[model samples]
Target: MASNTNLTPPRGLEGLDLLASAIIILDDDNRVVYANPAAEHLLESSVKALSQLRFTEMFLNADSLNAVFRQATENLFADWRQDLTLERSGREPLHVHCIVSALDKPGMAILIELRENVQQLKLDREERLLDQSQANKELIRNLAHEIKNPLGGIRGAAQLLELELPERHLKELREYTQVIVKEADRLQTLVDRLLAPHRRPHIVGDVNIHEVFERVRSLITAEFPSGLAIKRDYDLSIPEFRGDKEQLIQAVLNIAHNAAQALAPRIAAGDAQLIFQTRIARQVTLAKVRYRLALDLHIIDNGPGIPPEIQDRIFYPLVSGREGGSGLGLTLAQTFVQQHMGVIECASRPGCTDFRILIPLP
Candidate 1:
């Protein structure tokens, strides 16, 4: 047993620490005897604190889960596997695939493991997102390249025609030339933005993510001086990593800006809320690469959530939910984060939208 463990975990329980899924041990009486570190995160409590309560006390759906535990204990060498929704107070319900098996060992009568039911689905979705992001960036860059040459020609021709206009019709015809000039310039600007991510030099340096968060927080607060509330829950233990601070700031700011825009109605009623939360994630997998530690930054907003139909495609270029939106905010943000070898995922419901950015740490 590890000397620092808050609870007297049984011998050999140390093996459980390596698993990514949550694992808990229950005595014959269904009281918590041990919980691995992953379980501590899932339950949001320490092993010592959880030891005081029975396993059933941890969840709203305890009765049914306890029934499974009882069955496993009664039928020696028996095990059960089933999908379950673990509803806990003050937190979101978890949909997991639960397994309960009778353990012959003393003090640890039953072994219970909970794995996210959507684990496979999440992996597939992440792969698809990466593929889609890559294709979108390539297409945008190519299209911008094709558009750039014609735009210069159109603008220059419009300028030349404005100068060459006849004296009699100069006033009327020159206005039409000016329109062409302005519209060409606008499209040219748009093309430049499309190529910006690919063309910009990626500057890498030591990044303290909290500093980035504070910068974004100040920007949002200044923009929405009233009604919107910015709340922060920072994990001060997060270590500095190598990344581009300015790019991170821009990526976070874009998401926050969109969140503030979505909170317009709630802001008007003086109840808008946007929260910034940071935590140190352990043994996380990002972009198919596993890292011992990673930075988990979540930006949450209490606003009318993204429309379900467009949620899946929100990262695609020019996919905006708001009226008059340019729709490039999320696409650019995703691009910048990807540049840092990280992934950004969004989950939203009617009253909440959570944008999580995961970046590997040193």
Candidate 2:
């Protein structure tokens, strides 16, 4: 479809871009004035493509739409809300809860908003994740600290006991003391790793998301030189945001590394594919705070998906899908992202797994 370049985006409507709901504005003649990013995604068309398109030309059936539009414009303050079905490409029907209200603007401006049926459920899940993240952090900190304090004494006691042993029995006793000392040191190291993210100071800098991707890409590509194909579907227009550059790199690398390991079977078949996809999300809400734009970065892999039983607990410490895996990779990644007021979400099935990292854009 050819775009209508003659139509320009309306002024004083920039705030509309910050809305989570899909919004469209129409002129008195029923020509589309503007379509927000959410609206464009809902309609499966861009603002430029939908611009200046007459109401009848845009929809397969315009009778109901016209009636609702008229009902809304008749009374400026009376907003008409109803469930409506829109035909897509003449086959698929999209069900939407639509609200048409009159805008107090020149030329009989009408504002139409479309909302997804599951939007509320999605928001509730996001809220739950944020709350759960907070609780998990506190629990981890207390648990790590509790285990950390006694470790030094246990190791020191083992050394003292070893030195006090008699010469003839020293060889056998030394072996026993060595085990205690080594095990204590191992546990101490584990505790330190658990507390690393929280203990380290966050260093903020202007981070280009693509640079982070490149660093991860280089590491994964070298690790799996053959049989695996790493693909990039990046939106180069994503603006640089303030974050800890190294933290972002580690967060992405952990996800990609997990993907590479899961792709082992596919790798042997020489058909494995890992994709790094990035897009700019408009009007993002994270941890109850809303931002004008956010980064939607996806690490997708065509490998066996996460097991159903442990899918929800993947972010928890010591939860591993692979055998002998420490499972701290994703936990640390989540911590690092959370430090930046961002979140990492996972969606997995049989053939595809998508790990999304969302951060508010600057």
Candidate 3:
């Protein structure tokens, strides 16, 4: 943190230091006239050091900033750039949304506000996802109810029709009835599975995220015993939180199972790998609420990534990238996590796919 005791802040901008957004005031020459505390933190430099440098030295996209500053100063209006990439030397580039406005003060010609675009996008996406999940759950519940009653009747009618057929003369006819009965039963099972999460009462208990990972790992390993390798990188310091242990286990299992299935080709060639990593996420905003501490659990797979066409909708019910996939696995997992007041997100490329589940700690 930078000390403001020795420096005199510009007039009419004394409150810049109190803002959460990084703010920097620039002179007509595009030099740093003032840098707020948040700006100092964001630039990884103290106020004194930043004051000695030009605005161009602070950001790689200095030209874009200069353009915005020129426009604001000349037009005396506010201008903004969305999703601008700010390059830092020896550091990763930051995606930011910047706002520039003419300061209308001597020496301080422009006020620049920079906000982390990725974090804002994540928060916005999470809000939409949470809303979509709730709507999907309600639809599933209603659809299950509409299908359950008729399915039982169809199965019963098939059984009765089978019994009516003569044993020897109509054996083929009886087999047809058997097919109807079997299909009806299968549909019934599907309906039950669709409603399973809502049907069960949530059972809360102390949940160690590592235990959930271990259970999922054991299950996935047992199923794909030959080629795939399951790796664990855990943060044991993470404290236990309140959740339904069984539900969490099932949620993680679904994700790992999906990854294993996706890694089938690599597994055949003996190069498939699944990693379970855990860490403590600080100051995370999940589902619109900010949490000081959250558990960040990642299930990473070295497999062909999720198909781009369906990647965005992977969490929706009945949306699958693979053939004959029910697509309920991710939906159920999302619902389970939401029940625990958490959120899950994914980032994927050609060879690496990461599914991150974040849950608030007690």
* Least well predicted 10-residue stretch by lDDT in candidate 3: 1-10
Model 3, backbone clash pairs (residues 3+ apart or across chains), number: 0
Clashing pairs in 3: none
- RMSD in angstroms, all models? 12.5, 13.2, 11.3
Which order, best to worst by TM-score? Answer: 3, 1, 2
TM-score of each: 0.69, 0.67, 0.73
Instruction: Give the lDDT of residue 347 in candidate 1.
Output: 95
Candidate 2 lDDT, 281-326, residue by residue in tens: 8888787788998899999999899999999889988899999788
Worst 10 residues of 1 by lDDT: 1-10
Provide the lDDT at 127 for model 2: 82
Task: For residues 268-308, write the lDDT of model 1, one tens digit per residue.
Answer: 99999999999988998776778998889999999999999
What would you estimate as the lDDT of candidate 2? 0.84
Q: What are the Cα lDDT values of the candidates?
A: 0.88, 0.84, 0.86
Which of candidates 1 and 2 reaches a greater lDDT? 1
Q: Pick the candidate with the highest TM-score.
A: 3
- Please tell me which predicted candidate would have the highest lDDT against the true structure: 1
